[model samples]
Structures are given as C-alpha cells and as structure tokens.
Target: MGRLPEAPLLLLVVTVSFLTGPDVHAGKILVFPVDGSHWVNMNLLIQNLHAKGHEVTVVRTATSWYVKEHAPHYRSITVTLPQAIVIEEEEFFVNFLMKMLEIKKEGVSPIGFMKFYWEMLNALSNIHQQASRLGVEILENRTLLQSIRDSRFDVVLLDPGLPVGVLVAHELKLPTVFNVRWITSGEGHFVVAPSPTSYVPTSGFAATDKMCFSERVKNMLFYFLNTCIDKLVVCPHYDRLVDKYFGPDVKFYHLLQGADIWLMRVDFVFEFPRPTMPNVAYIGGFQCKPSIPLSPELEEFVQSSGDHGFILMSLGTLVKGLPTEITSEIAAAFAQLPQKVIWRHTGERPGNLGNNTLLVKWMPQNDLLGHPKVKAFVAHGGTNGVYESIYHGVPVIGIPLLFDQFENVLRLEARGAARAVDATALTRQNFLEAVQDVLHNPSYRSNMRRLSALHRDQPLRPLDTAVYWIEFVMRHKGAAHLRTESYKMPWYSYYSVDVCCFLLAVLLILKAAVVGSVWFVCFRLCRRRKPKQE
Candidate 1:
C-alpha cells in the first residue's frame, strides 16, 4: 500500500488513541469525607466526576457540634455516639501517658520501670481495643458498608482521619485514594509520602528532626512500640473483618501500603521543603472555589470601612482558645490602624474594644477574603485559611500556632506572600508594624497575587484533576505503576548505605570462615609433623 501523508497518519493514530484511551470506561467510585470541610473540595470533585459521565457517589457522616459550627449545610449522613466518647477515651490515654513520662523523667527504679511498662502497655492496648471495637460496631451496623455495596462501587476514596472509611475500603476489595487536607505527624502530609523533611516545627515546639541522636532513637522506639501495640490490639479485628469480606490473605497494611494516589490539599509552590512521591500529587488550594458570592453583612462590613480596606483575623476552629495576651496585642494593633478590622473571636470578649475593630464570634471567612475591601489576613495559617488567602490574592501576617501552620507560614514568608510573626513574640508594637507592613506595603500584596496566579494556573481546576485521578484509579485498578517504589522497599533497602554495610558484613563473615578453616588445617599439619618428630 502507498504510504499515507505524515499529517494524515499522525491524525489517524491520535484519533485511535483518543477513542481507545484508558479512561473511557471508568468504574463507579464511592467518596466518603470523614469530616465536612473535607467535603468542600471533595464535593467539587464528585460533581465534576458525575459531569464527566463517570459514576460517583458521596457518602458522608454528619456534624458533631464542631462540624456544625464550622461547616454548616455540608451534606452528610448524620449519626450520633454518646457525647464525648472519643474525646474522653483520647484524653484519658493522653493524660496517662503524660503521667508516665513525668514519672520516667523523675527517674524510676528498675522494678518501678518494669511495672510502669506493663501498666502503660496494658492501658494502651485497652484503649486501642476499645477504639477498634467501636470501629467494628459502626462499620457493621451503620449501613455505610451496605450503602457501598448497594451502589456497587468499584473503588472507595477516603480521608484517613476517618479510620472507619479506611477500614471499609479494605473490606470492599476496592482500590482507594486518600484526599488529605491537613498535615498529621503520624500519617505525614497527604500528598507526600512520609518523609523526615516534611516534619516542621510548631512555634512553641522544638524541631522534629533537630532532636539529639538519643532523643531521635527514643522517639523512634516509642513509635515502634506504639505500632506494635496498635497491631496487637486494633489491627486484628479490622483485618479479620476484611479477610472475611474480601479474602483470607488480604491485610490492612496492604490497603494502607496500596493507597493508589493522594490528592493533597498542598501546592508545591506554597510548601517548600516538601518531599515528593509519584503516587501523591500536589493539588493544594483545591478547596477555594472561584468568585463565589458574598453575604450582605460581609459586603456591608467591607463597604462601611472607608478608603483603606479592612484586615481579617481568624484563629481557625481548633485554636478558639486564644491567649489574652495575643488578643490584647491584636486589639492594640487595630487601634493604630487607619483600616477597620474583623476578628473572629470565639468567646466572650473582655470589655476592651477599639472603635475600628469588630469582634465577631464567626465571620464568613471565604466571603470576607473575596471582598475587595479586605486588605490583609492576620491568621493562624490553617491550611484552609492560608489557601483561601492565597486564592483571594490577599496579603497575610501569619501568627502560626501548631501543626504545619509554622511551616506553611514559613513558605509563604519565603514567597514574599506573607510574614510569619511568632505568636509568643508578638508585642503590641511588633503586631502593629506587621499589620501595617501587610496593608500599606505593595510587595506583600504583589507576592500574594503572584502565588495566586500560580495556584490558579492549573490546566484543569484542582477539582477536575482530583476527579480525573479518582476515575483513573477505577480505570486502571489502582495504576500500580503510579505507586511509589518506596512502598515496596523495606526501610533497610530504602537507605541503601545501610544495605551496603549489611552486605559487606555478610561477606566478611564468609571470608573469615574460609580463612580460619585454612589456617586451622595448616596448623594441624604443622602440629602433626612436630608430634611425629618427638
């Protein structure tokens, strides 16, 4: 046959590939957000997946009072446990451990140490057992599993903070991906596989990796011991259930180790010093939907603020317990500013009020940020709030308190998008200066706008990318190639230097054995000759 023109041949191949591409027949995906704000970006993904003609179902758990306060109107299937059950269980164990550490620090006798070990292990085991039992009860009785089966879901997308959802994904023999919204020391950051580099220090806390060798060893030992306790007390129950539902040989870590992909709420540009993993993708600021309308009150708050726009102060949901000193410093800063300030103060304010400052129990954060009258965000750098500020191209003064907040703020500072002022170091003077810098300075706003462009410049919206990958997992049965090699490599192998040393030791042992045998044989022959002469 005569050769076709290059353009026609290329077109024919492209047409065929497009028609037979892997994503054409994506399977049904069930997405369950453990908490509601997690639902914000997740819902967008679910909506996009449905729009893309893929089968997607979202199973949600409803508000605890916490969720109600922060994420009202979020869709979920509500269920109630006894009040404070999880918190009580968690606190008791936390206190017990704290006490144990105190006693150890005081220096226990050998006998006392042994006794303490036993008591601590037993208590920890019991706590895990209780949590596991509760997990089992919920999974079996809650109709969550049944709903997944009814939907005939081929895969489950889950948030690991909701352990039950992780457990259900295991039971169903479904490929799973994690949508991580925050940083967890235990699980590492969502988009990046666990790395020592991802460990960032909180303001009052010491650096995670800067510990002395002995301290690192001790922490590693504690982690190891804790994992053993969890494996002993908790994992068996879930693993057994998974085996019963799926197959005899399937394991819980297989699901954890097999996490197909992670759609992290982190943008690489914003989180410097981040570790990368192929199975993980950075899609931070995914939660910030564009140009959403603002409520009238927020609009009015913006409009009433004269020529200079207002500043936004929100400490986020977790740290409602703002220290009086911090609050006073903030109030002092507001008093000097020409701008109006909106503060999301959770509790009753002491009689101190500046005329320019407005204290609200809650203000619509996204709405306020979107407003043109908002000049800067004075924030705690919670991932959601930080991302939102960047999304709106507003300058920030980050007063980070905990978790990855310090690191997030540090990255923003490095980007010139924000400044990280230590909450503890905040004096009334410094606070005012920082606020003025963010507001009056063009550099901070210019930096923020640059990042905002980079954050928004994805070929696909974060939601679409997230949804495409969820469907990708369904289409490829987990795209096992996309899985990181780190998952397969043992710790020894991952640090190749250690592996090489180990191999050298083994070779030395073999060499020593051969040398010793030859020497012994020669000595024996020499001894035999001497004896005969005698």
Candidate 2:
C-alpha cells in the first residue's frame, strides 16, 4: 500500500550494501604469538581482524592457554611438547615469581645485576631452544608447510618477545609485523627506528626523559649490555634454528631488520617523550574495551560498599603464587581501610585477611575498574594493568615486581596519578598508607581523570588504528617505504659517532702538519745564521 520514494530507497540500498557486502580490505593473516600475556594481548588484535572478515591462523605453543580459551574459533597449530620436559603453567609462574623475589632481595649493583642478567639469559636460552625445536617441527611437517604456502597468507604478525615468530616469518617468506606488548625494546626500535640511549632509556630503568648524568651513564651501559646479550646469547640460537629449518640464506637478524611495522603497546601519554618512526604504531589501549556488566556476585559486593567504594588489587597472571607471609601483610593492610577490597590471589587464603576483603582466583579487572564504586587500584604495575586503570580513570597504588614494572610505575608516580612501593619493602603500614593516599587525595583522582581524557581523545580508537595499519601493510604487501634509513645503518653511523671520529682525525692531521712546518721554518733560520752564531 505504501512504497518509499525511489531516491530515498536507492540511498538506503547503497548504505546497506556498503555496510554488509564482502569486505574489500580482507586479507589472509598468520600470527605467531608467544605464550601467556603476550598471546593474550595479541588476541585482542586478532579478534578485531577476525571481525573484519580477515582469515587468521595462530601457531600455538605449549604455554598458550588464554588463546585457546578466548579465541577458540580462530585456527591454531599446536606445537607438541615432550612429556618429560613439559613445564606446566603453575610451575612456570612459580619459578618466574621466585626469580623476581630473588632479584628484589639482592640489590641491583653492577656485579649483582650482571649475575642476574646471566641467569635470566640462561633461562631464556632454554625457552628459545624449546621454541626453536617447535619451529623446526612445524617446518619439517611438509603437509603443514604445504598448506600454509598454499594458503598464500598476505603477512605474518609476530611477537618478538620470543624469537620463534621471526623464524616462522622468514620460513614462510612473508612480510612481517612485530607486535610487542610493552614499550619498544632496543632490538625492536633499531629494526624500524632510532632509539637514542641519550634520551630514550631502556625498558627497566626508572629514569625519566630528562636524565641526570649518572642516570644517562647507567642507561648507556644497560643498553650496551642488553644488546650484547641479544647478539651473543639470543641471536646465535635463533640463527642456528633458522639455518636448520629455513637455511643459511635468511638470518634471524635479517628478518628483524626487514620488519614492515612495529605495533608497540605504548602511548605518548603514558610513555616519556621519544622519537618513533612512522612504521612504529602505538596501540596502547588496544586490549581495553567498553566495560562489560559485572557478574551478579561482584555487583552485589561492590554495591554494598556504598560511597566509601572499594579497591581492586591484582598482581596479574604471571605473578601468582606469592609467599603467604607477603599476602598476609597485604591482607592486614586492606583490613585497615574503610573501603572494601577485591584481591586476586592464587595461593591459600591469608589467615589475617580482613572481613572487608574478598579474595578470588580471577576477576574481570577492567569492568571492575570502570565501576563507579571502585576508587583505586593496587596492582603490580604491568603495562596492561596500568593502561586499564588509566583508561577507567582509576588511581593506582603500584607495587612494582619485575621487568618494566618499575619503569611503568615510576612514570605514573611522576604524573601524580599513582604512588609506588617496592614489593620487597611492602609493609602493612606502607601499603595501607599508599591506598589511603590515592583514595583520599583528590589530586590523584583528578590527575587520573585528566589522563583518561587525554588517552581517549584521539582521532581514531587504538584498535581501529591498529587494524588500519595492519590492513595497510597487507594492502601494500610491505610498508618498507615508511621505514627509516637508520635501520640499515650501523650503530656508530646512525648516531654520527663515525662523523665525530672523522672530524677528530682531520684535526689531528692538521695539528701534526702545523707542528712540522714550524719546525722546518725554525731549522732553516738556524742554518742560515749558523756562521754568525759560531
């Protein structure tokens, strides 16, 4: 009885077609994610790609549990682990936390730091060998390699945290994009940009952008040491693996140097000022999403706290199984607060736990942080936890435990949004005071709200930016044009140290010539006056 006008109907049809028709941007994508938190972080980007109609496959390792649980539909090729040498998730985390505690106990003197560094390298070497073996297994499987080749994937996304992804990308002969879950490392930075140690501090040191003389010296030394460790210990293992699986034609270092783009999980708001190349895209809050409604039990618990609000405390997944004594101290601190506490604990319940505190094995951290009833977050200062708290405008009480955590918490502390306490020195009074300071102090909340606004004020959301660049790389085959010429230069040349040396050499040569000419003139004068002198 009633038909729409032809012009309006045509407009509606065109809009519908644009929205629902086959995606012109879709590409076949292959991802190589390191296990645990690295995989969890990459899964967010993977989900976005999948939703955009891109075909994706992830090569899963033994440490991958989150990917299987979260993105079960995405295709995966599991690397089999030998039963004799299998390391369970619980065991791995326990060892990691123990090492962290050891480092905390033994202060970071130069010698002590070197000792710890060697130990870490040894552990990493073991893991690298395991990952290499897995890579070899995958490549040796002719059927799998044939299928992957036949799929003709457009590009490979990799987490360079471990070296497996670099090997896989090279074997496939695909354009590579490195997805790192922390501030870009020296290795990652050198691949696509210049990382000047003069201003750009390494990941772990708690130095600001403007460093004192001592701090800069330490930064330079650490940068050099870390590079040596990577070259001597890490890269050689990867080289052997590449030679074994792919052949000597392609080296691991070459793969890294040729990376098309680096999807770094960092933002200028949170990070100190540093130079980044065009190929280095900062997707800081890519994992952060609009808060989901909390579970019924969590809602009730949080709502019961009234205007006093509650605090959310978690050390993240990798730092579980802390000592019971430490947990007891934390519990005692929480008991002193008027606000209720939601603590994520993996071990046995602390005997001194307060009535207002609730301990759970896991919690939806981001959703709880977004709740109005949540006032402050007590966390281990991991990048993910810090970003989520900042996204929700929740102030933080940071207890830095391990690598990069110290640096992250220090930045937040500098910004007036957080207070940090050393995990080794954490006492009931100190912890309670930190919690009280952030909750009662209006400045912390104000700073956090400002940061949250700044973080959210962007032309495009971080996820969309990440996806656009990912697709851009696929569309262009490789975004090599965006890469800086610095990537191809040696360290000395890139920093102009060679130029300085050449100038010094020229000055020395000129000085020597002047001295010789003066001597010759004095000798000739003496010879001409020799008879009169006699």
Clashing pairs in 2: none
Cα-based lDDT at residue 428, candidate 1: 80
lDDT of 2: 0.80
Query: How does candidate 2 fare on TM-score?
Result: 0.89
Q: Which runs in model 1 stand beyond 4 Å of their true positions?
A: 1-28, 36-39, 47-134, 142-147, 181-250, 273-275, 292-297, 319-325, 424-427, 485-490, 493-502, 506-534
- Deviation from native of the Cα of residue 494 in model 2, angstroms: 3.5
Candidate 1 residue 13 C-alpha distance from true site, Å: 23
lDDT of 1 at 472: 76
Candidate 1 on 1-534: residue-level lDDT in tens? 998999999999989988876535645776655443454556666656666676665543232323332232233444444333332232453355345435634677889888877886665445334434444655667476576567677787776544456666766767888887542224334224554522432222324445666656555665565456557755665577667656866655555667788887778657645456777766787768665666787667677887988998897765443556557777876888888888988754734468988888877788789877889999887788989999899989998765457667766887888887876667788988888877788999999999888888888877767877877787777767878656556567777878799889999999999999999999999999997899
Model 1, backbone clash pairs (residues 3+ apart or across chains), number: 1
